[model samples]
Target: MSPSLTFRPPTTDDAALLLAWRRLPEIAAQSFSDVPDDIDRQRAWIERSNARADYVHRIIQVDGVDVGYGSITVTHAEWRIGTIGVYMGDRRGRTGIGALNFAPMLNHCFHTLGLRKLVNQIFDSNPRVLKGQALLGYRHVGVLKDHALKDGTPRDVHLFEMRAADWAAVRHRFGLFRDMDANVTG
Candidate 1:
């Protein structure tokens, strides 16, 4: 069976773990913040942001061990759309945790939130993420030229989006949710 994947509301106790992950050189380089260490500020940010009517700040747990972070920000809710942000902070490469975490998040965005569309902003430097998103059916909408600076160099950021109907048709057709569905049957 595919490993169980779940997301829980991040608590203040998770602040340190989040800070450590965020400070990692690889993680920091991809972040817009560009700060090496900001524990105090990070803690405050965590406490201030929690489960709410329109947003969810979650700690990604794979088989119950914290492995990453995720966020769903609802925008134009009345119109049914939101933005999803996720990262595998603990980089155990090729683990397939991304697919596990992603399937549910994408499902949640469309089914639970009743969102018609979803969008993600990613750094061009992070081609791996971009490629994965594309494979999972996100379309390149556009790019903002020199929108973000990384390591003192200008980097382009790209925008990607997916519609709920499009995703539903592919959820199983393209094997996006095949593994998860297998678990359900077997």
Candidate 2:
């Protein structure tokens, strides 16, 4: 299905919710950077994000209720490539809900923003995300074995990536094909 949730860039008013979401135990465990407890520090992060053209931090809202965060870091503007990251802080459900959130974000990247390739690395500990990524048409490109630490324990990182073409080939199966076609042809 197409997205029913709203995807918008973060604002100063979101500092508190952002702080709390990052502090969620599951989110913190997998994050590459630490989430400081201070609200000012969180706002400082939003400021930094605003300053970078390649960085985007979005607050995911469903019917005006904040539920998660999604971000993409453009590693190569010339190549139309980037990296994706997301985490749900306040909601829990069956595996497929990720599609509801991911389809729109990716549609924005691939069609609206003109990104060609998107890549992301998932901690092996988070198998659920891996499954979601696979279902979304991302392919396993490589792995960094024991390359990162979580609570002093090393965890392997699995890399997944998709080109615009890759997404097109599978979009129909996931209900993301129609909007893309309409945007391109109409």
Residue range 1-186, candidate 1, lDDT tens digits: 766666777877777888888777777777876554667777778876763678866777777777888777897788888998777777642386655567767776777667899988898888888898887888999999999887788889999999997788667733444221223211
Off by over 4 Å in 1: 173-186
The predictions' CA RMSDs to the true structure, in order, are 3.8, 3.2
Residue pairs that clash (backbone atoms under 3 angstroms), model 1: none
RMSD of 2: 3.2
State the TM-score for model 1.
0.83
Q: Write the per-residue lDDT of candidate 2 for residues 1-186, one digit (tens) a residue.
A: 633566677887889988898898989987987877999988888998978989766777665667788887899999999988888886741233557677766776787667999989899888888888988889998899998987788889999999999887877665643231124310
**Cα deviation of 132 in candidate 2 (Å)?**
0.6
Shift of residue 78 alpha carbon in model 2, Å: 2.0
